[model samples]
Target: MMADNLMQSPENWTESQVSTWLRTLCVKEQYIKKLFEEEVNGLVLLTLDEDSLMTKIGMKFGPTHMIIQKRNELFNSKQNSQQNAKPTRSKKTKLQQKNNSKSLHCLASSEVPSGQVHARDKCASEESQTPQQPCILTSKENCKPRPFDQEGIDLIYVKHRVLQPESGAFDLISPCHEFKSFAIAAELDRTRLQAKFAKEVLKFATGCMNIRSNGTIHFGVMDSKEDTGYVHGEVVGIPVKDKDIYVDALDDIEKCFSTDKEHARHCVRPPRFIEVMDRESTAKNYVVEVDIVPSVYILKGKVHAVLLPNFNEAANKVQYEKKAILRRVGSKTEPVSDSDLSDFFQRVKERDAQREEAEKTLVLSTPFCQDLGRKLTMLITSGKKFIENDKWFIFITNKFKPDDLSNIEWLLNMKILSVFDFDPDSKISGLCSKYLEHHAANMHSLQSYSKSSDRSIKGFTEKLHLFEQTSWLFCNGRSGFKANETPCDEMTWIKTRMTLLMVYVSLICKHILPKGSLQVIFLLTSPVEKPLLHTFYGFFTEMQGHTDIICICESETNFQRWQSFAEEICGTETVNNFSVVGMKMSHINATMQMIQPVKACAKKHLPVFVKGTCLLETNREEHMASLEILTVAKKHLPVFVKGTCLLETNREEHMASLEILTVNHCDDTSKDFINEEKANIEQQFYRGGRVTWMNFWLAEHKYVGEVIERDAYQDVSKLLMDVLKFPL
Candidate 1:
């Protein structure tokens, strides 16, 4: 009724006054000046009502309400000013005023009764001098009133009764910028401001068990892609009917989370649902935000589509149809790809393999174990020979538990040690234990001797120790030891003597060289000694010998048998020997020496026979005592010797200049003796293929005839005739 009585012409109002009025109406500041300019130029009119103002100027609901209140106050004040005095107007304003008045009169005549209009005018005139306050009170309570303006207009507070104020208006609300993990929906029913989708939203919300990290999802504000995953989606504003509607929205959202099956198990704290108003806008609208407590573990399952805004296909324009699994990728939430999942699985597999390998590694905790490990590494890296010798060295591993064998396979495969891990419960186990004890004993003895800095250990005790160490190999016989009560059986005595000799050699050489470098010789007398020979062969072969092995046999059969055994065990065929001796071989001193140091005889182990032949007369004394036969064949001599012999045409001085003697084949059987001089040198007197004149040259020296035979000359002469058969 008051709006009908009030009238106003805004043409005379200054831009600043209009701007101040528009600001109170909550119109944006930038738009107020623009609107004012257009209004003054007649392109726009200020007479429009609240609804029309929103449609044309795009003002929000709150601003439109304020604009309506200000308009009525402006017309009321105009009425008070009109009764006092009328202001002069320009021609443009006057014309505009006439058109506006006609429009107003037409509206009043058709819409209102004459009596009501007159009464309204009377009331307006009476109250004109006394400015009336604008009543913005609801039926429940009258608002706090402000004083009237000088123009008899009420100064109502433009901002009144905010239905949903800023988020700060709520006491228990979380900060706007703070991240609280939860699911939030701005409007369940935008018009009614009800959380209609609350139940559905809660299902997709990363539950306390699933929410491994701090984050949030909010709806209602403008869906901003610019918001870092802090607030997943945007909410422009959700229109609410009133504050009560907002309370209902909160209740709906909170109840859904409270009823969730996973929420209680995963959530550390009770989920909170609160009403947060859009501070960026002045509308009676708010966001229904629910904060769900996070869990330490990630939910490794599918999430409901309705809970995720991006997955809501009907409402959202997302790539995924009904469901989308969104994961945090750095600062953004993105879907996981199949390739990434596969790569993650691959990494997990690799990690498991590495863990297994680490568990299997040998633990070098003790000093002995550490030292052994270092030595094994060195041996494996050195070459095959060291590793082969140490293979049987598994005897040292008697102390190793059965479980240690499992981890030791890796070391064995790397050739760090040789081992035959057959039955752990076999008789070999006892042997291994004995070997270990022996090894420890030897190592301890060596260490003790070193520490004492003494070389005076008695040879007899050493020899006794050596015998006792090997006595375990025999069944009952103390091979080389003699006792008065067990007075000498012949075989036992020989066995005992041989055993003693073997130990003696080993002990004496122990100081001068490593056991592997010494060459061992054993006398072969009888067939029963073969087994004993085998035992000795195995022991020495395991030590890795540096030189040829020797065996003095009393019979050819024994020698051949020994040679066969040597070839089988040592993988070599080269063997030489002296004539069999029937005399007691034990009388000879069992000496050990390097063969290259002794020089006495010339015996070449050449390929003279069709298959195999020994270098005859290898014994130094035997070779010198026997007759010397100079046998030469085609290509048999060295190139240097052949070169010198081929130049022996005038052999008088040159033949004597040569260190090696030569023999000439005599075909003529001549009885003439030639004395060659420089003036009359008879080089053709003795002409034949290069050979040694054994008998003819023997006549020159009395002792030489004893060593060279006449048959040796004939044999050479015939060998030369056969060589000349091939055409030169």
Candidate 2:
């Protein structure tokens, strides 16, 4: 009787009721999110299992996805009630088709082109007969959309954005209430865009887990509800496995939009959005097509990883040790600075402060500054750091100019491959196995920074160039883990580990970035938390451009603080204080080797580094490059040293984007030291074939850290008073 009177029916229900209902089921609410409405089919079948079996919970399906799909069916089915209402196409005359071909032939001779055809010739081919196909995939026959594949989903991915943090300031009416296309400006609202993004991320994540439970895989879509309105989210697969079996539709999008993208700053053509807004125009429609796929990162299984230059086969291990631990939320540990993390947030805070500053500074730049406001969107989208360096790990390299290689000593001895075109991990690994005689995870280091004119440093730098294309992923399947919970919820697997590590390292002043380094904050609530805001904003609040990147990202947009930091490091603008993660893995997808060496606590009286021998060599030409690579590695210096190191920065012009610097003070006085050094450097700088180091490292096994018997951490600090070593 209660179901009969109230109107939650699809035809009469509003967005508010739906959003409120969805909130109650999530947050470990016992059952996965579902919806219900029965009168239409008498029994609204909630396709719980892929078998299409129906189970009626109430007047409507209890799950939101089923409810939304039903809503879409009802609306779309009603809208297209009259399938017979078709329009015939205007046939092109044989003479016109022939004339078109003849004109192309005539034009090839560099003659004046044939007279212009009627503008009407550009009408959509649909003006003639057409068969039904997937909607929006193609622009049209007449549009001849420049081979633009209809990645309608690609439109959903927004580029990175600079978030602002201000309590009660710049806060919106909830993103769901205003969420809309961040890419399409004509119909976009800033506050709405951010809200929509938050809602969708949450929805997509929850829906993805739900779908996986039924033993069925899905590609791109889920459903959401918020204060502003309803949203059908873009869903893709999570990598529980290392294959692209699920989310294949996204693959289609990626195919159309080549993965390689540039910032296209100051381009003359209108934003691709302008063309999309003019979707009716054939010429513009051709320009508006794009893929709407999101980049997918999966956390599954125990993958192996190997280090370079040195190794400890038996000591190798991962940062985290269990899958249950990897997935556990709040079942783990606490963050070092929750109050500080929230209060010290920087992305949103800095953005807000900068926006205020920009508002104040606008008068200074006049026309130039005026143009900046519109570019807010552009900067957010394309302002990514140049990280095309392989993914999955931090890859340090010596970025030398094309002509400047080959004179270095290492280059002279090594028969290098095309430095730009080989896999550093594979080549390095193969070389190490065959020639270095060292197993994976057993890399050696030089005893001293400058045993011979710092030439070895230069050689190492040049060789890093050869490794520019190398790929790697970090972690011991036992130790490394990630998750998709809130940044504040450090209790989640990934967050807890990062938080603990950040705290542990930040405790020391030598650490690159200190704890609570951030001073801005932004918190996005799920529709379940704030249904009123989501119901009104609807799809606008569920966009991907506004989503955070540090957590689970279901879209292609790279909108996060880490991405922001990377962009600044890689941007064309001058960087006074260049900072980036220092790790050996980046790109190239190399398997992980255990980080076993530092796992167990060593004798307190003598740090293991004191016992390990240091192997040193010199190559004059690439010495500078080598120093720079070393600087990046310094970030993790204390790890092997129980988190301690003599810190310095690379000031050289050609730092290869990796922050490393070699100690400049060294004496290798062998005869024509200076002259021989320069000549030797010039001789083998190029074609270093750094990949051969895998073999070269075989004979190398050395380690360097202050002797543990003394308090080196404090001693290094006292020594720091003097001019620090050459920040190679």
lDDT of 1 by residue, 408-473 (tens): 212212211112111222123423343343232221111122212254445544533532232122
- Candidate 1 achieves a global lDDT of 0.34
- The weakest ten consecutive residues by lDDT in model 1 span 587-596
**Residue 680 alpha-carbon offset, candidate 1, angstroms:** 99
Write the residue-wise lDDT of candidate 2 on 1-728 in tens digits: 32333233333443334434333223112222323232222123211221132224322112333233333333333234333344343454343343233211101111111221221123225223222222222111111111112222222111111111101112111111112222221122333322333222222222221111101111221112211121222211111121122122122221221222111111111112211211111111111211111111121111111111111235542121121110001211112244544332333344334434533443432222122211211222233322111211211122222222211221122222111111123223322223232112222111111123454534743543423322111110111113311122212323223333223112221222222221111111111111111211221122212221111111222122222222322331211112211211210011010111211111112113543323233333246554532211212122221212223233333455754422222222244554444343333433352222212222231221222233354776867855455322
Estimated TM-score for each candidate: 0.20, 0.19
lDDT of 2: 0.23
Candidate with best lDDT: 1
Which residue runs of candidate 2 sit more than 4 Å off their true CA positions? 1-44, 48-437, 440-728
Q: Count the backbone clashes (under 3 Å) in each candidate.
A: 13, 140
